[model samples]
Target: MKDRAIERDMDWLVQVFNWAVRFRDDSGRYLLSENPLRGFDIPAELNPRRPIVPRDWMEKVIEAAGPTPLRAMLVIADETGRRLSAIRQLQGSDIQLGRTDAWPHGAIRWRYHSDKVNKDWLVPMSTKLRTEVDRHLAANPVLGDAPLFPAPQNHRKSVSKDRAGAWLLTAIKRAGVQKLDGTLWHAIRRLWITEHKEMPLRERMYVAGYLNRQTMEMVYEHIDPLLLQETVETRREYREAR
Candidate 1:
């Protein structure tokens, strides 16, 4: 079979074999002992794809977005460290600009069932990010419990869900942040995860919305050169003082 494989038409072969056994088998229930190749995965490289741009470039993209929906979308990335699902799930009413916590930072509260990860976690709203959201909401206004940015003015639909990709990609191009990594949105998550890795395990977990320490460590941990060097140098200085 291997020797004549290229000439034999692998695609048609599998299709015909499946049809014959599934439909024509006498019992229709008889099964082979195993199908060893059933679980095989396609190589990622064999599939064509682009990648994420760096965070600095992403920031530049948001700047280029100017007063457009593009800027609001990017600012949400900075504020919530939210998944795109979480972002889309927001209603203009959900942003709590009026809430002032005793905590140093401001706050954002949305519903528990709003996104894929069904937990309700409140993210700290840094002053800078808070200002950004207030401004975005002010400019965009509320058409409904729909997308913050609908299609371009000429297009006819108000967004029902998951429109971050289209607008964000346009923003990226406009900003000229063109080098691509495999998952662009993920790079935003990566930015948040990397930024907070050094916080105590419990604290980082709470901020990133992990239910507990172990899951947070397992999923979000990444080594940072500056942090590692700071730890090592601090230890050496302490030892010298002793």
Candidate 2:
């Protein structure tokens, strides 16, 4: 496995050990004496910067995707900026259409268990997103707890992560977009974040299901200096000096 892949495995194992150490039986005795790997030093991961997908490239790919489940996944990724894991496992129950107190238009409830952050996010759906989702759900027609995108072989389970990635690659090829390094499903997410950089930091973080501000600003956002310069030019001080 690659270094980052191995690091992720070690992290998951450590979490397992921590859970086991905390588990108790009916007798109130600890299930495990201690986390064996509790004090183990995990090397810092050297992750490469992920490039943001251009809007035109993404649109081309989405258009080329046809009516497959991948098309919906791409739209969700572009609109919500949430992880692919959450998108793949989306259920009919997760969607609440029509006006709500929280969301006047509608909302998509991202369940805690399905995400890495372990936080439930009620994200308001954009008009474009709602239209696409409505079209998909109308055709697909899933009831409560039924996965929006079920596995072809087994309808009981959602499509595997590998399968989803493969579908995306296929779409990219059909669109004739040069698949650059680090431009994966997550790249579209970065694009979403970059496009919404004008929003208040905390509010953006909440919408994006981010727990840490640093992670959102440092990892997910790709700052465009030209865009920043244009925004700065609009400031009172710059205008007054002209």
Model 2 global lDDT (CA atoms, 0 to 1): 0.87
Best by lDDT: 2
Q: In candidate 2, what are the lDDT values of residues 49-129, reduced to their tens digit?
A: 578899999999999999888998898888889899999999989988878777776889999988889998888988888
Residues 122-160, candidate 1, lDDT per residue (tens digit)?
667777777787788787776445555555652334443
Best by TM-score: 2
Model 1 reaches what TM-score against the true structure? 0.64
Instruction: Return the number of clashes found in candidate 1.
Output: 4
What Cα-based lDDT does every candidate model obtain? 0.61, 0.87
Q: RMSD of each candidate?
A: 8.5, 4.1
lDDT score, residue 3, model 2?
68
Count of clashes, each model: 4, 0
